[model samples]
Target: MSDSTKQVTEHEVINYLKEHPEFFINNPGLLQQLTIGNPQGDVVSLADRKMLQLQTKNQQLAKQMKQLIANAQRSEGLMDRLFQLLTDLSMNAPKGEFVSALVGFIQKDFASDYFKLYLGDIKLSDDEVCVHYHSAQLKTLFASFNNNDAPLAGRLPAVKLKALFGDESAAQSAIVLPIGAKAAHGLLAFGSKDDQKFHPDHASDVLQKLAQILAVFFDSQAVNDGQQSQS
Candidate 1:
């Protein structure tokens, strides 16, 4: 009848079992002291009692493995499309055709409902695609991004949505990938009518790589234009 010997806490018992996994095997008499209640309400062997815990642990590990595999597969698919996009952009063609092809390839491969490619001063044959903006205006609109070059996804305010899309833009959510404020002074936006299409967690490193490639194209085209003017 002492306070210290009243009872052992559940934490101590669990810790003891974890630290000494062979305790039950070493003392067979201890197994008779442990019992787990099942739906059938009958006693099970110690092995049967531990089976449920082991099965639960296995299921958790399996779930984690499945998630990892899914992520890897998604990344692989993006890389393949990116390679195709790069190959398309590398072909020898007129500047107008090059930009048009770049936009077309992205629209086809990325499954975007609506998209806007904003370049500083480029003129497109299609007036609908002539979504150009000054670098200062872009810096202001995307100031929320903290000047980082990563792609952003999720809902945008009505003003930012209108600025990126159009006045009658029907996009409920979108993904914005910054090309370069200094070099290209451009951005690529993918919009979707479905709010869940570009949910907050849809960030992809592939889009950042795509943005970098676009910056290179813009810089190279600038150089090409300069050469043509001199010749």
Candidate 2:
């Protein structure tokens, strides 16, 4: 017989035993007598070897499916918790807490690790927005840009904001969203350690809604501030 016809390896033998355990399972007489105890005869056959491999593959596939299901359920639960937290922040939090909640929303809801919240002077003549708040983590990561040097200092090209933010490999991606009651009054920027998180093609509805809410809140706050200043 050719080399291919030779007896298989020990790993194949063990694998065969696992596949069709029924082969020996039903025949207790042969199962007990065919082991190393009676290794004189042909212990395991080629058919048994193939069956074992198939069984092993099937078991592995089942394990993978189980893991996938568990992960899906976990993700769903996390989303539910996140939604609840955001709802509470929006409806019941104080004005000072709004910026913190906004940054938290970007980080937790969208998986962004770095973000900025710019609150423009509604009373200013130009469309000027300044970084009034930002994530503490982002402050640490890019300390140089936190203060007056924040992206708010320079006028940026709307078309190229993505390229500018994504250049530093570490900055990953960014977004510039306008916040205002009627027109845009502020901007929200998000960056990531993973470069793909904030691509220009990423969806904007969620962020847009966030900007709108913030604009309304800020405008209201500005009115309150003016009243207090006159008082």
Candidate 3:
């Protein structure tokens, strides 16, 4: 027989197998010897190749599910901590002590390297709360917060951080949250030495809630002080 004739015969056999899907079922032993190259260019039996694909897919799915569970657990833990903080703040501690407690909780639980509370116009005797009267410096330093009432997370220019925190500030990443709007505007800044600790894409829901709770606390204190002064 000619080589061309042999090639045509081989092609005919392949075509016949392609047309008959049940050929493998009738000859199950042939599947053991049939080999295919995987993504790594390693030859493996047909069944082994299929099994490897399934294993890889399962590993990927497992990893994703594990990450989701870890995230959920972290969220739950944060909520619990927030509830505890709220409860602690509700005890009507002294003004200075209250500020201390707030900062203490953030530093101990939230793992923040630096925490500063900036009240735009509200006066607080507590050194923890830095009262900044509205000025061009304030506006320029927090340009990213202009007219925006949301939380911001990311790096800040060295000059801006120095202006807000201090010349000795060592934070590489930060979260800035606007407390009250309009006349009672204030800000809460949390910072960390780790650059990636706070990013624009980080979840802000919990941080926003924390800021709102603090705003209410500050506003309540202001009202109480006003009533006392009037009396």
Candidate 4:
């Protein structure tokens, strides 16, 4: 036969084997004789290669399952802590006491190096926990915060870090969350001494929820203050 005819016949044999998968089961000796070439220029029995592939896949699946379980446990713990914080805030602490309690919980429970709440034009007697800034100042400082409600986490610029924290601040990383939907109120900033503590890829769902809860507290305080002034 011609070389072309031999090539066509070889291809037809492969196609036929694929179509009749049971053919190998009937001919056990043929399977034992089949060898496949490996990337390392070694030859292994086809059956052995297939078994190795299955073992690798099973190992990968086990690793993935373990990671998923660990993530779920961490998430449950965080949820429990968040619920406790909400309960504590609901006890109707006075304005100064509330600010103190909030800052203490954030610093101790959340392990934040520095935490500050900035309120635009909203006056607070506890200047240590809260800061008052003009609308123009906020716009100028946080120009990159396009989505006001979204949390921003990463290494902050030196100028921005100095503006938020004082000139003496030694924070390496930070997370900033807008307090209100319209961002008319202000922002909540959390700083960390560890540079890798906060990154752009970090998940912010929990932080955003916490910011929303704080917004409710601020709004309630504003309403109460308005009522007291009218009385």
Candidate 5:
């Protein structure tokens, strides 16, 4: 017989084993009888290697499960707060009333050190929380968002902090959510004293959801205002 005919390829063995998964149970002695070589040049019985592989896989799965649990627990409180905020804002509120309610929630439930909101050109005077929408600054800072309702989270330098909040000592870390569809309606910025409070890696689905709703709310109002003006 030729060498090729005599040789039992690994693929054939794998296919055979897969086709008959009960092969191991039927030939139990092969578990100890067969030996495989590892990359470390160690020869271990098939049974030992299988057990080691299973243990490693189990450890990896356990670690993944723990991380999933941690993320879920962290999001639970934020979800509750977001739900409450939505409930409060659903009272056919005017823009000024909406801003007040949101600022209150941010200070109390969201634990933000400082927060600012900028909507379209309105009659209200400029303040820390409600500011005139400087289109140029927003365009510069959030060019990456491409003028969409996306949230930006990370630490900001003194230069950026000074430009946005008019105070270099405004915040160490911050989250900014752009509120708009195509043209920007405005933005909401939350600042924190803690340097590690906000980060790019931190998943903030709740805030993104709120920003989308705010964009829709503002767009609908603008449409209604235009209709009333025409009438």
Candidate 6:
């Protein structure tokens, strides 16, 4: 072929490839045709194939990410419904039934298998009902803290909670939340077993609000209980 007729560079071959819509990459014979005209054609064709493959892979990954996001959104919606149900139950339920509902809701939603709502003592040692809730598997975990122990004094980190509770233990994770002001009567221990389910930093703004509402509800319950006692 004449010097002018010969393909000189990979860029020129790439341009030629752009112009050729009929080229189908099926066999070694076609590949050879592309590479023989100029060695640059082989490099250009390989580079083109790599770029195309990367783009296709990225598109697939994007689809998977979208699906994951959608699934997460649905899960969050379900959780919202459950929280709303708990609030409704607390408001309309009979006094004893309301407390049972709150406990059952935590056990079901948090998947702790066992948990307790303790009132009148934020200091853990001051109360045994709360401790017994985790009695089957974690009695020793609280040996270090007592009612005399100040709040936040011996708090366990998320990782430590998981280790002590056992990854598979039905009540493996616990969160100690002091509701209301220091004068408030109680602390709530929210526990669960799934390691990835509850983190120390998990968002609980909604739960905090729920606790606030529960504090009010319990306060009202206490007055009624006192009235009955006097009667």
Per-candidate TM-score against the hidden true structure:
0.61, 0.40, 0.60, 0.59, 0.59, 0.41
Superposition TM-score, candidate 2 onto the true structure: 0.40
Model 1 residue 82 distance off true place after TM-score fit, in angstroms = 3.3
Q: Which one wins on TM-score?
A: 1
Per-residue lDDT tens digits for candidate 3, residues 1-231, read 887676557789889989998999999999999998856788989999889889999999999899879777877888898788777666355655665676666666665777777655444664544445445676666666666777778887777667667788788888888776631456777788888988988767766776777677778777888999999
Could you tell me which residue pairs clash in candidate 3?
Answer: none
lDDT values for all models: 0.74, 0.56, 0.73, 0.74, 0.73, 0.54
Which lDDT tens digits does candidate 5 get at residues 22-109? 9989989878999999999999999899999999999999998998887788678767876778786753568766656665665665
Runs off by more than 4 Å, candidate 5: 1-74, 77-81, 88-92, 125-132, 147-149
What's the CA error at residue 49 for candidate 2, in Å?
36
Two-way TM-score contest, 5 vs 6, winner: 5
Q: Write the per-residue lDDT of candidate 2 for residues 1-231, one digit (tens) a residue.
A: 899899899999889888977876576676434433224564564456556669999999999899779667766765566567667765434665666555655566665555656554423223223245333433334344334322332223433343334443355456656565322354567665655665655555556666767777777776778898999
For candidate 1, the C-alpha RMSD (Å) to the true structure equals 5.6
| Residue-level error in angstroms, candidate 5, position 65 | 7.5
Clashes of 1: 0
Q: Relative to the unseen true structure, what is the C-alpha lDDT of residue 165 in candidate 3, on a scale of 0 to 100?
A: 71
How should the candidates be ordered by TM-score, best one leading?
1, 3, 4, 5, 6, 2
- Tens digits of per-residue lDDT for model 1, 43-120: 787767888789999999999899879877877887887787677567345656667766666766677778887777
Worst 10 residues of 3 by lDDT: 126-135
Backbone atom clashes (below 3 Å) for every candidate: 0, 1, 0, 0, 0, 2
| lDDT (10s digit) by residue, model 6, range 151-201 | 231235655455344455465445555445541545556666554545655
**What TM-score does candidate 3 reach?**
0.60
